[model samples]
Target: MCEHMRPASAFWSFRENISPSALSVTTDGKHTVVGTQNGLIFLNSRGRPLWFNKKIRKVADVSVSTKSGKIAVGSSQKVLYLVNLKGEPIWHRELDSSVIAVSISSRGNLIVVGTDLGKLILFDGKGKKKWEVHLSNSDFPVNSVDITSDGEFILAGTDYSHLYLYDSNGSVLWSKETGSAVLKTCISSNGDYLGYLTSDCKFSFCVKNSRMLWENTFDSQPLWIDMAQTADFVSIGESSNKVNLYNKSGRKVWGFANESSRMGVMASGGGNVILGNKGGIFNYSLEPYLKRLLTGCKRSIIKATEENLDVTESRKIYDVASKNFSNANFSQFLINIHKARNLAREARVIESDSVPSERRLERNEVEEDPIVPQENTEDEMMAKLVQLAEMREKGILSEEEFIMAKSKLLRI
Candidate 1:
């Protein structure tokens, strides 16, 4: 299934090391290379560790070439190590400054590193120097670097707000002033698009030729951004709330909200995206885009049942969706929920005029059982409000969830 249409499933999650900060993940086909403050850990598709290298302390960055399955690790100790799937070192390069960023090409023929001294170095697969570039404006340090899958384009971002694009022979293609500081940057697998997030909280995208395709500014101050292999979409992870999804055209497609700020984001060949944080990593859907659609379906189903429009079918579908909402098999649940949504939409069409109010239903307006009497008096509503407030205060629900539930109670 194409990832943009495939339903998402939450898969195995692994906790970050005790340090939590300075975390990243690299995907090399079937292997996942995780870089933490302490060391490098390799995991398989099932999130099982295949091998680990604790010898490199304070691993600052990691890159994995999917075509060649070569793993690159950069450390604060000013060293870069290239290893294979079995965790065997192929070569090591000691640099002049602490390594801050690293990237590997798809076939593993190209390697690039960014350092605290504002130097960008490129190396061949055999550890031979290909080219190097030094930036005088990288005073804030070289924080992020990336190379195209075919190893044709190179990108480096610094805290001084300068972004440099390089060609295969180490010549500067172009440079731009993005923002006060460049937080992160990524390149599409085919080398057609480049995306970046800035310290001032702006996420922007550009074509390979440096023409601005689209740009978006955010208040969440996203921590990381990555381009999908197809360059059709980008994912930005915010420090406080949602991990947002945007298309190359700058359309906001989806947002996955969590309590914590995930550290890094990675895209898969199938368009699936993974997020890593202290609580572990989570897999979220990129294709089917059902989260919003499902919510609308639930609202429509309730309205249809209350208006007596194909009541039997609407209620049946509603019941199934309610059960599916609690189901552990999320991928299957999404598929089934979508079917239920179709039923709800059909039911609404059968009796469109029955609901004269026509106001879009709020989250609080939908009754789990539309047949149940919800006409509570104001005093009764206050009592329920108190009840919900107590539940929220008791830590029985997340603050956001509590607020939503309370809003629903007030609607009653």
Candidate 2:
């Protein structure tokens, strides 16, 4: 059963049997598509159902091609069903295992699928296999796959606690270790950032080079996260039945909670945010909520470095405050300022300790040649020195002349 809560002004409700495993609301808001656990497909709006899938098993996931009007449904039986807007199946293909997820490239020419056995398959728009990569052994399952908007690279999240990146030609570029099982991942429309949620329920937003831009941990497992291209913000929905909005800097802006609903934030469009839950579908306007939250006293905590400190001994003194402040808010601010000051003082101490001493010898004084030639040419004198040294071994050279030539060579 599905229940829905639309905007108070719209008063729309959508009812369905067997909970939806996945939901994709069209960009135009003219249609919403849902895939159910019973292997059924439904298309509906505020009023009634427009179409349904005929050959139903469990539908693992669904994707709608905005440009081509093609709806692709992946099934637990390892087959993908492609249909037109009218719910007529156009093509179907079988795979080695169940299809867990699917995504269409921005141009809608390629579709990427993540299989149950950690395989990433690429298919053309006509439902022909382009290439298939077995990312891991059968022990691992791929949870999600995403392609950059420009189709330059592909990213896959695996159950073995790793994320794999592949170039356009299917060459492995790089892989990163994540904290836990990666549940879902999404790339921004502009292809500038990628966001992912781990099994531990933490979210990481990263740039192209794998540098983490921001990371946020939730008290409950995150169900889904989405980003907006025009704004430096992301919306995250957690299993605790709360939706929290975060700025690009990783600060929580606002949060809404619905205790009775097992809800998750899906996609935001046309200033309206869409959410899915056991109760059904819900939409909330963003303008009023964003304005009200931004106007409030929404202070964020940030780590401060020594260069950030303006006052002397600020960090040392702030360390003192950290031990004393009973309130977390006030203590964090003081700690940052103190950290900066302490860093400056330490830098000054190091600079003073690095000063050179005046008693050290000059470069020329430490290296001087002999003051005079002893006997023959410079080479003969060295030969004579060697002969005298050998004679001294046989008791031939006198001690005084040997000392004299040695002193001359030593410039003594």
> What root-mean-square deviation over C-alphas does model 1 reach?
13.7
Cand. 2 Cα-lDDT: 0.58
Q: Which residue runs does candidate 1 get wrong by more than 4 Å?
A: 1-9, 20-30, 137-139, 290-412
Q: Model 1, range 1-412, lDDT digits (tens) per residue?
A: 0112222345666565544434434442234677777677777767777777878778888888766868888888999899987788999988889999999898999999999888899999999988777875444589999998788989889887888899889999999988578879988866667988888878878777676656777766787888766664577775544666664445555655644556756543423455666757555544444334456566666666776767566556656655654543333344455467556655564456632122212212332222223446653354345434443454544577566666655554
Q: Tell me the TM-score of each prediction against the true structure.
A: 0.66, 0.64
| lDDT of candidate 2 over 54-130, digit per residue (tens) | 57568877777656787778888899878777888888899989999887665667778899888888887789888
Which residue segments of model 2 deviate by more than 4 Å? 1-11, 44-47, 229-231, 259-265, 268-270, 287-412
Highest-scoring model, lDDT = 1
How many clashes in each candidate?
3, 6
- For each candidate, the alpha-carbon lDDT, in order, equals 0.66, 0.58
Best by TM-score: 1
